[model samples]
Target: MEKRFNKIVTLFAGLGLLVSCVSENKIEETFGVKKLVDNCVEKTILTINGLTDADSLPRNILQGQAEWNKVGIHDWTSGFWPGILWYAYEASGDSTILSNARKFTEPLYGVLDVPVDNHDLGFMLNCSFGNGYRLTKDSAYHDFLLVAADSLATLFNPKVGTILSWPAMGEKMGWPHNTIIDNMINLELLFWASKNGGSHDLYDMAVRHAETCMNTLVRPDYTIYHVAVFDTINGHFIKGVTHQGYSDNSMWTRGQGWGIYGYTMVYRETGNEKFLDLAEKLADKFIERLPEDGIPYWDFDCPSIPNAPKDASAAAVAASAMLELSTFMKSEELTTKYKDAAVSLLTRLSSDDYSSKDKNKAMLMHSTGHYPNGSEIDASIIYADYYYIEALTRLKKINEGRRL
Candidate 1:
């Protein structure tokens, strides 16, 4: 009887060890997150080393070296570089990455000194200070972000029922009140502020903006317009058009990715079924239209299908959003479908086809920033790396059964 008991105990112990080994791998080796994370850490250091000024943030890498987003140089993308560091720190558990993240993050405090006339503050601060606050639990970061949230709310025209995306650009284009699809990304900041310590009205404002966009921005086919214009006095949507898209009728991949991520986050924050439904719809439309490799062209209607520049940035955001969205699915089939789609995107991006391992310091390549403006075409964009790391981290958290 003693011998039989010992044998059973040994069997159970072996099973426990197997489970531990599996659990230790936050991502499956087949998925390549572990390798990619190490690469991300190394590349992040390389990116910082290339920078000469602390105030200038790394933005893109088109070829041999890195580019920057400065005070006036595509400053909307400023937050992503620091955001990448934070995510990299979380993945690698390296204190050096933490210090680097804080170093790049503090310089953005200068953003508060200037007037907040544009909606990009959310893109600028939330990705940097917002992640910092979440990870460090620093009250100062929270307070700074609250001020930014308040500043963002100032642009919300109750008349238009949406946060104005471009205040100065509206003047340039003769738009009374213009709201772009990218404004959807900013709603997360408002939602986070409402739950943390700021006014609950911030939550309400986010919901209102989302609902308004749902009604005007999304078209009948479910592909959305890039920009929606509203009459400032009457508070009615005037027309939908394109600024960065191939045409007024074409769906821009990155804008669609923002809508997918924004609605997914709004659903998480509000528990509203409508937002979930919309996110699912947007996600479905995006997934069905993707190319064979799952990375999207800059525009679905670009007139050059097989040859159009792929937007790895779009793929990164969609994968991250879908991973989170998968947890919210009510059905197992829905969950699997979304997760599989996300995995397909991540796998392709993690593969040699997209990884910028030997080519450049950036994690992934071939992202389209603004094709119509002829900017950052087929380049290594900073935000793409940020979201790619974030998606991998989300995969890790999901494996650990932790909250995202």
Candidate 2:
């Protein structure tokens, strides 16, 4: 046991060294943000292009494009990569990137518009159609978004006041009565639809569901449960379980990050003091436990495992959330602190060791998808890349106004 503990200590110490090295070499070169964004856009486009071949799909980290041909075009996960590409293109204003994103995403128009009862409509249409609207100001994207929103609203259960997770994956692995922290992201699309589509019912339903989640799923300490099982008949909370984390009560880092940002967004949309309060509370807990380098382990309170590593993706996601929270706050000092922390985290990630220049890797590094179940760890994830770019974009816009 002593030997194992020593190994864990050594691993953390090595990671601490990497953090120090990155901080020492923080790149202050002009246009560094733009360059990183451009690199991510270019690499992601190439990755999508490569996945067109069957042999390359399994090896492809992002959703494998070759799966599209075999499984047909409606695959949900396949849309996320191109969706992110569209987002990056919109942010950077590169016509080529936009063109590539359209080429990759246009096929999904038929699939997303087909009235499917999937939980991932937000994942599919929001990133693609939503981004297309943001980029091109095309009414078609808005129309698709409203259509998808209407389809999503069909999943809402009046008893639970939340969207059902999926149709019925089956009894053994079923989550029909389950609500997850990740679903908070999907609610954003509902909020958007409510505003733009002129549906007060949609808006009210989204708010009520968000309130239900806050009451049941979020702990007093601000750590979030991965899933909450509700008694549909009684309209009461039954129990909490970890669908993705290590255990029932473990604080999954990314899930917490989702809560942090999701609540802030809710506050933004509704002007609800409770949502803002929850966002601040969750942010406090998250920042308090983060390592000195700003990244966190997959679970905040988990026992360390050999070869299991920290997740920079969670850090990147939380940093973006912090920036959002900073803007919402009235205190200048607090805002500056949050902004500085975000910049520090992103600067560390952009270092040579973490941010791979190779087109194949395509992300700022040290992302862990799932550690307890032995999934991708210390690897580049698409969401990590997405949030990393989002952070940089936020920083660039802020710095531009401040002018050093």
Index of the highest-TM-score prediction: 1
lDDT of 1 by residue, 1-404 (tens): 99999999999999999988886763565475676667778888777777666677777777565444444323888899889988888777888889888988988888878777789888999999999998899898999999999999999998888999988867788888999989998999999889889999999999999999999999988899999999988899989999998998899998899889999998998899999999999999999899877789999878888988999999999999999999999999998899889889998998888998777778899899889999889998889999999998887677667888
Question: What C-alpha lDDT values do all the predictions have?
Answer: 0.87, 0.73
Q: How would you encode candidate 2's per-residue C-alpha lDDT over 165-282 as one tens digit per residue?
A: 6556325555447778877878878889998964778888789889999988898788999888777686678877886687899899899988987898889889989999898898
- Candidate 1 — worst ten consecutive residues by lDDT sum? 65-74
N/CA/C clash count, model 1:
0
Give the distance in Å from residue 140's predicted Cα in candidate 1 to where it truly belongs.
Answer: 0.9
- Name the regions of candidate 2 deviating beyond 4 angstroms: 1-32, 48-76, 113-117, 173-176, 305-307, 401-404
Worst 10 residues of 2 by lDDT: 54-63
Best prediction by lDDT: 1
In TM-score terms, candidate 1 sits at 0.95
- Models 1 onward score TM values of 0.95, 0.83
